[model samples]
Target: MCGIVGLFIKNPELESELGRHVSAMLLEMSERGPDSAGAAVYRNEVDSGRIKLTLFSSQAQPDWSAFDRQLRDFDAQSTVKPHLNHAVVETSKSLQQMQTWLQSHAEVRINSSGKKIEIYKEKGSPASFIDSFKVADYTGTHALGHTRMATESAVTTEHSHPFSTGDDLCLVHNGSLSNHNRLRENLRSRGISFQTDNDSEVAAGYLNWRLQEGDGLDDALHHAVEDLDGFYTFAIGTREGFAVLRDPIGCKPAIIAETDDWAAMSSEYRAIAQLPGAAKAKIWEPEPAKIYSWQRQ
Candidate 1:
């Protein structure tokens, strides 16, 4: 099993509290997952043309200067900020070109990239890493987090959840997909590459492939329910909005709470109860095969 938490703030006043709220929610569900933890934070975009790439290196002390120089070789200007085991690089190059250049390197892996999204994840406990990373200090419009128990994959950072396959689009899944091996082969044949063997990564790739075909978030999720064979719950976050969907059988646990200020969802009510106005929020379990989406205005 895994723990999933998402928060979308509608009130401008609550924007700065996005990370704090999400951090609390994630810690609340720490017992559900002890293998790895991750989070995708979406903040206001200061540079429309630049993309923020969150990268991971197996080395505790990575050669960030060399990586920045490599980006410059591609005619892209960049700024690198190193965290504990990950780094966030903001570059002016197009996403396609940037990805191509990064793919050639063996040591670095791109976690997520977009104008507003910055992803941070590692192979460790959520409660321990959350404070060290100062996750509560981040400010964003929306955010999603995952704590993985590692049912099908190894307990490595690469196998962590909140997988990102496109710009500003990330997915965190609970439960397993039985047909993921078959689906992975199909996606690979379509020219879609996967970084990890994790089933959750396949889910992200499937959504990215659908979105590339001109499907909107809602439409893509509708197709996902029909195409992907699994007993799962998905909490996806994009630049435009946040969405939640459950399999037709509804085997995985999910709860949603919505107040005038924010919309929050988690594996259990205790996670959402930590929110500012959760006491007065309308809370319920999402129905099976139904799409619940909230977009930013």
Candidate 2:
């Protein structure tokens, strides 16, 4: 089992400790997945779009010092440090150029040019890595987090959740898909690259394929449910907001909470109940095969 949580605050300028809120939820579910934990925070700045690059490996040790040396020259704000078996870099650049620059770095995956989208994830307990690096120090109104306990694959930074298919698009999932191997083969045959052996990557590839064919986020997600087999709960995030959906069978758990200022969701009611102002809040599980769309307004 895995734990997934996400929230979108209405006011970007508001002084809500979103990082703290999300980390708390993630930690609350620590026992669910002690193997790894991660959180992505979204920020909106004047006009300088931000980018996120995740560098991970089990065979090669990432040289963050060298990487920092490479991007220090860019005329943009950036943050870099060690993350379990990887390094996360947040910068400002066009997606094409960033992808081109990272083509040679097999250990790196770049998500470029969106609102402040900084992904902080690692292969360990939530407290272990989340504290080593003050990821919460970077503020954002909307964010997503995941605590992963690998059921069918090796544990590595590459297999962490909140996998981004594009600059602002990320997907966090719970539940095992019985047809992942077949789906993985299908995706590879279609020329999609996969870094991890986890089934969630298949979900990411499905979304990427849909977007490549010009489908919007909502349609892409709707299509994914029909195209994918097995039980799953996916919290898909975009630049504006996020969408949550479950397979028709409702094999996995998920809960949603809405307030005048925020919308938070998690794989369980306990995580949602942990949110501020949620002590007496009403929370409900979205029906199976139904989609719940929450905007950042």
Candidate 3:
């Protein structure tokens, strides 16, 4: 089992408070998953043609300056900001070529990439990790977070949740998948690669593959309900929206609340209760096999 939370700010004036709202929701779900925590935030785009990539290193202190110089050699203007063992790199190079360059560097792993997304994750309590990362201070239009209980995988930073397989797209899962190995193999044959053995990562890759094939986020999730076999609830984040989905059986717990300013979902209602307008928000449990999405207007 795991905990998942997502917040999408529909009101432009409330965009600056996205992180605070999400952080509080995540903290409320801490007991559901105490092993590791992760979050993906979609902030303002740096530039029209630039992309942001979050990279993680196993070392205590990575040589970010050296990596920046290497990117410059490829004619990519870049800037790096180190936070704990991970760094966020914004560059004006093509994502495909940057990924190829990163593959040649064994020490650095790309955690997430997009024009407006930045992912941060670590192997520790969600509360403590939030404090260290100052997640509440971030400003963005939408955010998704995960707290892992480590049922199928080891407790490591690489195995954390909110896996990102496409630019500005991320997924956080709250249940187990029975046929993930089979599905992973199928995706691999289609040229999709995975960083960890976690089933959540495979789910993220599946959605990424579908989107790459020209399916919209809603269509991709609708297909997931028919193709993937398991009991799961997923909260997916994209560059322009957020989506929530559940298996046909709907065994996993989930609740959603939407106000004029924002839409929020969590594993439990308590997580959403403390939001800005919870009392007046429309709250309900999402139906099984239905995709609930909120997009920026």
Candidate lDDT values, in order: 0.89, 0.76, 0.89
| Cα lDDT of model 3 by residue, 1-297, tens digit | 789999999888998888888899999889988999999999868788888899998887778788778877875578888887888988888888888888778888888898888999998999987998889998988999999998877888999988996888999999988888999999999989988888888888899899889998888998888888888999998898888999999999999999989999999998998798799999999999999988876
In candidate 2, what are the lDDT values of residues 1-297, reduced to their tens digit? 999999778655543577777777888888888998877777644255665555554435667777777777653476675665566666666566666776666666642235556566778888886786465565676888899989978887778887876657788898888888988898888877788788988898889888887998878888988889988999988777788989999999999988766788898877787667887666788899888887644
List where candidate 1 sits over 4 angstroms from the true fold: none
Cα lDDT for residue 76, model 3? 51
Candidate 1 lDDT at 290 equals 98
Q: How do these models rank on TM-score, best leading?
A: 3, 1, 2
Residue pairs in clash, model 3: none
The lowest-lDDT stretch of 10 consecutive residues in candidate 1 is 68-77
- Looking at model 2, residue 192 earns an lDDT score of 78
Residue pairs clashing in model 1 are none
* Cα TM-score per model: 0.96, 0.87, 0.96
Candidate 2, residue 279: Cα displacement in angstroms equals 2.5
Model 2 misplaced stretches (Cα beyond 4 Å): 11-15, 44-62, 71-93, 111-113
The C-alpha RMSD of each candidate to the native structure, in angstroms, is 1.4, 3.0, 1.3
